[model samples]
Target: MKIYRIANLAILSLVLSIAFATAACAADNTVPGWDPAVLRDASTIKVMTTEPDAGEHWSNLWVVVIDGQPYVRLGDRSYVRIQRNTTKPYVKLKVADQEFDKVKVEEMPDMKDKVAAAMADKYWMDVLIRHESHPMVARLVPEAAPPETPSH
Candidate 1:
């Protein structure tokens, strides 16, 4: 009876340690806040990871930071996870080699034109000249939220 009790205590301690270790691993997976400093002066970037069916996601995409916000323009035919999701998507942004995984994404299809006009002025000679002439813009909104930790 004494040996059985000691074994049970050891097992309980092992389980608790496992649980704590798992939690620590999860915490390491996501960033806590929007660190704008990282994106302060980045050039061409691949902002998102492609969905499973999409082929070769990283095309040289330009990023425009306007009024303290970041925006990207994607075409109507673009195969993006954001396009498929009815509600705003959960986004992870990898900018300047740092990953920010706790962002809430919003779609701004209607404001595409307005955003383009704004970008034309801000980016000037260095803007996406081809798209600017056509102006097919898609905007993404990211918010700081509960970190979306990946689960095993």
Candidate 2:
């Protein structure tokens, strides 16, 4: 009887853990667009990307907001992986404590100079790498949820 009770308690805990994780990731989309202000104060965000042959990996990246959109600039290796992933444009992001599971990554070459200026303004450390030519800027836009249909 005691063993059965213990097993039941363990199952309950597993269920609750999954539920909490789902809720955390569901706060993902403030879609239409991310107000740059939402992530403006956040210095860095965690980017989760799937490698070509392996599973997903998370990298910490400095974030900057321009015209109410969030953008991150990655170094060569990360940039190469993104280019390889031509089919899927989505990546996961964690800003502060919030996790976004379906954030689309759009590379904006035309905004290169603007993004650089914004990063330089937000991160004083930008001066160190700004001189080098790491020009891949990926804008993070959350996926909007589908519209709910009324019941028949």
Candidate 3:
């Protein structure tokens, strides 16, 4: 009986450790010049994940910023394209006058409810689409710029 109790405790500990590790890996931080307020003010942002071609195209998606993190829930067509994209997680974003060439698309399933709430608050027409199924939520993280070589 004591051995069984010990085994259960060990299992619990392992589960907790894994949970914390995953949370750490998905830590939310904003890039220096990329302001979350810009997204919050803008109604829709253009996102280009796949290379431009005859069939594929850019997606105009709604964005919300919760605690300095930017999140987007792609429309059905965009979602399919993003999933099938050979480039995968890399996306180009244009928010208002700001344009980012290579922002990383981090799918954040855990933030579905939070992102939903923020979206509903920001978008007046959210009531019309609130009943739609919750798809995978995405957090946008800007990639670091490569270091430039010093001039001779």
Candidate 4:
């Protein structure tokens, strides 16, 4: 009975260690093109979207980070850009001095509430804007780096 109790305590310790390790790993996994420290604190970022006819359209807008991923909310005018992104997910993001090219933009309707909450936390204006604008939430996924060629 003493041995069984010790084994159970060890198992519990192992499980707790794994849980803490996973949480730490997630905290370290910062979104690309964004400095982890600034992602949640920066006021705005420059986003360039490809327009079907008008070429690249650039706009500086508020960015929110949720679960280590970067998201942006678009109003009626910018919402059209999100539709355009459905076909061409490629986009450019400028966060401070860092610029990320060819990043994929995916609309995340399911994360609207979460993104809005993050936005409200970051910006006081969002408290009022959230009520006035029916915004669409979109996630920015970094483009995968190209494979390296083997030198002969």
Candidate 5:
């Protein structure tokens, strides 16, 4: 009887642990550090991309935070097509596994100059401070309508 009880408890613990791990993985699959509402409501955002000119470095762009908000950081020298096209109201955003539509672009004044400088110093890489002059501002506008039928 003692062995049986101990075995039962161990199995219970293992099951609970597995359940917790599965939940964590599911959460991780979504954008990190974002509420679903913010993702749906945000009009502008930064996008992290692979810099074609940097030879294996990441680039950041001002983009629409469509669908859902995910964590994003843009470098000073990112692409401009997405920003320019937003004037015609053509934009999209990919956050995690979801895609956002109707993103707008806008410029934001420099608020992270000190932080950027510090990071550059630590990494020993040069980062441009005149990011605003580089035309790096953009906003993302998501559709307001929810799906008529949500998938179960």
Candidate 6:
């Protein structure tokens, strides 16, 4: 009886552990868009990209809001993680303690000048990035939230 009880308890623990991990993974897979007000005042945001070999990679980046949207600019030879975003456009972002997952990334060359100006306005050092010969620019847009289901 003692052995049976111990075996059952171990199985239960395993099941519960798996359930919690699944829940956490699901939560980390999707995130709602940041509030416009939050983006306006925030100076920096963390970006997480899907790395083919390592799963996910994170980096701190300067952020600028242009027309109520957030954008990040990378120099031509900067860390290549942001470039991987071209193929796997889904990314995770964090501003302060707020986390946004599964946001869509889209390259925006047309907005280069506007984003550069915004960056310069937000960060004095960004003036150099704004002048880079060929900077890579991308926009981060929040994914639509899942619809709520009726509770029974």
Return the TM-score for each candidate structure: 0.50, 0.68, 0.71, 0.70, 0.33, 0.65
- Which TM-score value belongs to model 1? 0.50
User: For candidate 4, what is the lDDT?
Assistant: 0.78
Please report the candidate that would top lDDT against the real structure. Answer: 3
- The global C-alpha lDDT for each of the candidates, from Candidate 1 onward, is 0.56, 0.79, 0.81, 0.78, 0.43, 0.74
Residue lDDT tens for model 4, 1-152: 99999999999999999999999997663445445456567789887877778777888778888866788888877777756753476777787778877677788999988988888888999878888675678887776557679999
- Residues 10-85, candidate 2: write the lDDT tens digits: 9999999999999988865556445567688898888777877766777788888887678888788778666665
lDDT of 5 by residue, 1-152 (tens): 99999999999999999999999887563323335554434444333333335323223332223234322234435544433342344345554445554333344434244334433443333355334343333334344434569679
C-alpha positional error of residue 35 in candidate 2 after TM-score superposition, expressed in Å: 4.7
Candidate 5 regions exceeding 4 Å error are 1-79, 83-87, 110-133, 145-152
Candidates arranged by TM-score, highest first: 3, 4, 2, 6, 1, 5
Count clashing pairs, candidate 1: 0
User: Compared with the true structure, what per-residue lDDT tens digits does model 6 show for residues 76-136?
Assistant: 6333776655446767778877887667677899998898778878898865655665556
Off by over 4 Å in 6: 1-33, 77-79, 85-87, 145-152
Q: Write the per-residue lDDT of candidate 1 for residues 1-152, one digit (tens) a residue.
A: 99999999999999999999999897552445454444546665554544656633434455676555667665443335455533336555666776654344445667666667655655665454635243345444455556569999
Looking at model 4, the pairs that clash are none
Residue 120, candidate 6: how far off, in angstroms?
1.0
Q: Which of candidates 1 and 2 is the stronger one according to TM-score?
A: 2
Candidate 1 stretches greater than 4 Å from native: 1-33, 37-40, 54-56, 76-81, 84-88, 122-139, 143-152
Alpha-carbon shift of residue 148 in model 5 (angstroms)? 7.3
Worst 10 residues of 2 by lDDT: 27-36
Better by lDDT, candidate 6 or 3: 3
lDDT for position 93 in model 3:
84
Better of 3 and 5 by TM-score: 3
